[model samples]
Target: MTHASKTTTKLAEEYATPIFDHLTGHDDALYIPLLNHAQSQGDVSPVINLVRNEENFPYAIAHPLTGIICLLAVAESAYWVPIDRIAHSESCSSCAPIWRDLKNRVRTLKPGETFYAAATTHSPMGETRILIDAEDLEN
Candidate 1:
């Protein structure tokens, strides 16, 4: 299996926090299937490619799934954008929290430490969490 698929399956099977439960809620039914489809058909890359081709693509950065995907793309060094676009954009309001969270994660990284993007989970109410695995950086 691909790394994304392994990560998706791990998240689907291993984690069960209340936050995850709440975020998933009803959409839990669709999350795994969509994740599988994205992995199988490589849908994630097209979304990231759009971001690469157009940094200011209207709602691309603000929609939860796409936003988290963009964040993970950046995290994995697959996409690049100016710091201003990530931090100061009113156009990406829905993604503001993610930007802030990314900054926070970076701030906590120790010397010789690195991180890897794992997966994104889309909630029923249109929220997203970009999973990162600092422990799996070597992989």
Candidate 2:
């Protein structure tokens, strides 16, 4: 795990409080920010968002490469609320496909490359949470 401080300016631009970048499918523009945030901070735990409720339905993860794609079958502006790990464990089984695809992409990632996805009940939804290790990257 790693830790880093982020200024309000940076947060506003990336994690748009009232307006987010849009949690779309696995693309570069959507996921790159999450990866960049994690890489800059040296940890993936901080930038990841988890959604488990219907109120904050329709969430998308922004990618620096692919723009924005819907991850949870939600709209482009959906807001996702975070849930606990217990909920995540229980809901993850239903949400395995998303992570499986992300993992597959991770396997093909190169150095300085990044991926993003929405976290479900079981998986952490919202911004791109997974960051490939620098050493794992070929570049």
Candidate 3:
């Protein structure tokens, strides 16, 4: 496994909360669950009023090795799925709608799963999104 993966895994275990890929940006809706988990773990605050200003268990900004921003959301939260697009461009390339496929993909996500979608060398704006359980995604 890459050092970043190892670091993230270790951090996840230590924090006992899921760390999501941050490509979707900072949405309060997503932060709620994460804060709840931390609060449950004895964190003084339950709601994260300010992510950048956090004092305890600050959410990681990026994977240590991969340098990918980690979004982080609590498991089982009713969150909005990010819009999927082609690898390079921000536009969707599907002639036929793939809504069902995307929906199914999101539905299958569990607590320990890490959904990674980001740019790669081969494809600058990599379109392919990978959903691997925390156990399976380890480098």
Best by TM-score: 2
Q: What is the C-alpha local distance difference test score of each model?
A: 0.32, 0.31, 0.30
Give candidate 2's error at residue 125 in angstroms: 19
Clashes of 2: 30
Clashes of each: 0, 30, 7
Return the lDDT, model 3, position 127.
Answer: 31
Q: What tens-digit string does per-residue lDDT give for candidate 3 at 18-113?
A: 223222234423222211221224632122222232453323333333344333322232111111110111122321233333334445766544
**Best first by TM-score, ranked:** 2, 1, 3
Give model 2's TM-score versus the native structure: 0.28
Q: What's the lDDT for residue 110 in model 1? A: 71
Ranked candidates, highest lDDT first: 1, 2, 3
Q: What is candidate 2's lDDT per residue for 1-139, written digit by digit as tens?
A: 1111222225423523322322322222222222332254553322333332576554444322222222332222232322100012212343344345435555687765664333323224434332223332222
TM-score on alpha carbons, each prediction? 0.27, 0.28, 0.22
Q: Which regions of candidate 1 are displaced past 4 Å?
A: 1-47, 50-91, 117-132, 135-139
Predicted candidate 1, C-alpha RMSD: 15.2
